[model samples]
Each structure stands twice: as structure tokens, then as C-alpha cells.
Target: MATTSESEPTTVETPGSDDQSREGEIFDLLSNQRRRYAIHYCKREDDPVTLGELAEHVAAWELDKEVAAITSAERKRVYTSLQQTHLPTLERADMIEFDDRTIELTDEAAELDVYLDVVPADSIPWGTYYLGLAAVGSVVMAGLWLEIVPTEAVPELGWATLVFALFAVSAVVHVVQNRRMRLGEMERPP
Candidate 1:
């Protein structure tokens, strides 16, 4: 009979064991701008998109030009990169179904939206905004507790209600904005 000591480590496989690794893989796949653009394009389409069309749109976005304005050279560079590198990576990850000419998103591709929260360069992140709001609320509560003249003008219950209202409104707006920021949620990629 084989015996194991208490000091020995054992491994147990759980149904959700792969979730963390899968999330990491998803993040890695989305880290590239071209891959994200390709995924966004496929996501917006109800059917598969041709490789040429995907490459043209991606190149145009990268160049900040219209698809019609994209130079053949620019399109070709993006086409080659997607064909040789990005597409295969995404396909292997099961995020997209890619053939020689066309690409379509798989069910797994939709899962990526949960991880995509697009924040513009000039905008603050939702987490930061919430943190700031919480800080302000705390300061206000402190003032009320200390019976500061302005804060004391309102009853404690009224102040509490006001604070709750602010957070409630902020949360609702956050949810709406977050949904809009998700990949493929808007006319353009978030």
C-alpha cells in the first residue's frame, strides 16, 4: 500500500479551476490593439466578416482614416499581421472561428465583454470616480457628526438620506455608462 505523509501536498481539480487562467488568457489576447479591433468588428457583425474587410477596417482605425482612404500598403501590412499572427492566436484561444478568408466570433468571444471596460485617455476610471465619491461622502458625514453649521442645518436623518441619494444616482449612472463602454455595445468599438 502507498502512504502519503501529512507534509506532502496534494492537487485537487475543481470544475472552475481553469477560470482564472482563462481570464488571464483573455486579457493577453485583448492586450493588442489590432486583435481588439478585429474582435470588435466581428462582434458587431451578425455573420462572418471577410479577412479583407476586417483588415481594411482595422488598418483604417489604426491610421485614423476612412476605410476608403486607407492605402493599399497600409491595408496589406495589417492584413499580413492579422493573417500570420493575431488571427491564429485568437482562433487557438477559441475566441473566434477563422477560416482562410472569413472570421466570426464564437460564444467565448462574448465573454470577453465582461473584461472590457473602455476608458478614454482623458477620462477617469469608474473605480477612481467611486473612490472619490466615497471620500466626499465620508467628509460630509464627518461634518454632520461634528455639527458643522451648514451640515447641522439639516437633521442627521435628512443628511443620511441625501448621502444615500447621491450614491444611488451615481451607481445608476455608472451602470449605464459601464454597459455603453463594453465592447460591441455601441455603434463603434468602445
Candidate 2:
């Protein structure tokens, strides 16, 4: 019979590169997607919620409540009561003097924050960049029509007519550009 060493599990700790004293393992209490959802719900939350309310929210999202009900969730729910709810309260007291760079977060929220950023700011409309370019193109076409191209010299055509002509040409170019963009083609036409 092989005897197992019962000292304890070796926890992974981060390097103490900074002055803050959070050198030990950062608790990934909110790492679980369900727990994260609950925490996010709490972040938006006006006040601290009871465990029962959080459990209800997590349970509601369960497509297979029968499966998650037995092990991961039921046990996890109690664990979450400690991990997601109580531990956070405890960790609130475990604060290192905020030196600005030192982070105090679970392994999950820290990882997530890398991607999602910590700020609760609203999202930018990326489409606005395209719309803005289109507006600039219109303005440039107008300038070319009014200033660069002399219409009367081309016979009967006025500046307005020149603007319309340039706009027509630009429309073709715009459509082609849009088509290429939709197809994810970046090569310029030769």
C-alpha cells in the first residue's frame, strides 16, 4: 500500500515584484461563470444580495438543473455562499494599502479584466468610424465639385452638376470598398 503525503495542497503564488503584500494565492472565487454572473449581478446591484437570491438567479439559467443540481451547483452553491459571497466580505478586510498598480482580484476576474478591462464604461459604436469616413468622403467630393472641377468649361454643366458627377463616381467606389470590407479582403485594386 502506497502512503499519500497529507501535508496540504501546494498553492501557486505570484512573484512579489510589487510592494503590495498580496504574495499568496489570489482566490479565484468568482472564476466560475455562474459565480461571475452572480458577481456581475451584484456589481450592478444596489445592495448586497442574500445567498438565496443569487442561487435563484444561477438556478434559473440552468438548462439541465437535474445534472448541475446534484454536484457542481448544489455543492458549488454552498461553496459559492462562502467563496462568492462570504469570502469577498472577508477579503475586503485583507486589503493591501492601494499603491495603484497592485491588483486584488480572484484569478478569474483578473484574467477576465485583462480582456474586458476593469472600467464599467459603456461600449463604443465601432460603426461610427465607417460612418465618419463616409461623411468625410461626401465633404471631399463636394469640395472637388465646387473648387477643383470647373463645370461651365465642360459645357452647360454647373458646380452642382460637377458635384453630382463626382458623387456618382464616389458612390461606385464606396460600394466596391464596402463589398471588399464585407468579404474581409484588404488588398488594394491594381
Candidate 3:
């Protein structure tokens, strides 16, 4: 009996794997609204901010009011939550560096903006809205094709142009949204 040695490629973890793991961690840490608010506040600031300032912004956001309207009690409540819970969790996830007095975002924290989407209540989801637009555009096109709608004033090509314009505008908006969602990357204007 001959014993044969079989060779198999050993799997090595890529650098991207580390990034993916950190991204997952970031998503988990940012799952809480307070944590998300903390990240947004940190990104907006040019310098490291005190916990008090962060809490004020968070409290204001939570209460759906202006920062000037944030009461001391409200601020303190958010401050305590941040100090004990959110900040530490973020720090653990390597999203931010925190100490007793001040906290600052790390490079990893910059990657989190992509996951934070703020949709207004009155607005429909983008997918649904786009579908509705396409439906309307299709009906208009069909009307023009079948000569059911009056096109004597406006040329058939004009109706098609309107549909095309609508789609083009929507595409531009979607591109802008995608650019905003880019994490840790800067978009430079030519």
C-alpha cells in the first residue's frame, strides 16, 4: 500500500477581510440611534468634542428640537448614556478614540457614513418612488403612441423628451445619493 500526500492550498485572510470585519463591527455599534448620532456629530466637527457637546446634539436630535432648546436634564441624560454606553461601544469597535473629557472619530468611523441613511417620514422609499415615476412615464408614452392623448399642441417627440428628462433627473439624483453614501472617500469636482 502506497501512502499519497495530497497538497491543498492554505486559505489566507486578505486585508479586505479585516475591513469587512471592522465594517460589520461598525454596523453593530452604529445600530443604536445614540451611537449613530454620535458618529454624525463627530464627523461634522473639525476638532475633538467634549462629551457635553455630543450629548447636547444627541438630545436635541432625539427630542426633534433645536440644540438651543435642549434642557440641562435632557443633555445630562444623553451625556450619561454616551459616557457609559455608546462611546465605549464605539471605542471598542475602533470607530472612535475616547477619554474622560473628549472623544474623536477614527479613520474607521469615517467608513460608517455609508450605512447611515436618513429618510424623511413623508417621502416614499426611493425604489418605490422610481417605480411610480416609470409607471407614469410609461403611461404618457403609451398615450402618445396610441394617439389617445392630444399631441397636436406638443409634438410626439416632445412627450418622449419629457419622459427621458424625468429619467435623467432621477438618475442624477441617484448618483448624488450614492456619492453621499460613499464611506471614507472624498469626491473632488473637476
Name the candidate that leads on lDDT: 1
* TM-score of candidate 2 versus the correct structure, residues matched by position: 0.29
Better of 2 and 3 by lDDT: 3
Q: Global lDDT of each model?
A: 0.87, 0.43, 0.77
lDDT of 2 by residue, 1-190 (tens): 5455788666555676442343223234333455444444343343455555445444544433432344555645654564545445534634211122222333333233222222112533334544665676677567655675454466334544655665677668656644443211222110
Greater-lDDT candidate between 1 and 3 = 1
Clashing pairs in 1: none
> Which pairs, if any, clash in model 2?
none
Residue 143's lDDT within candidate 1 is 84
Q: Sort every candidate by lDDT, greatest first.
A: 1, 3, 2
For model 1, what is the error of residue 151's alpha carbon versus the real structure, in angstroms, after optimal superposition?
5.1
Better of 1 and 2 by lDDT: 1
For candidate 3, which ten residues in a row score worst on lDDT? 181-190
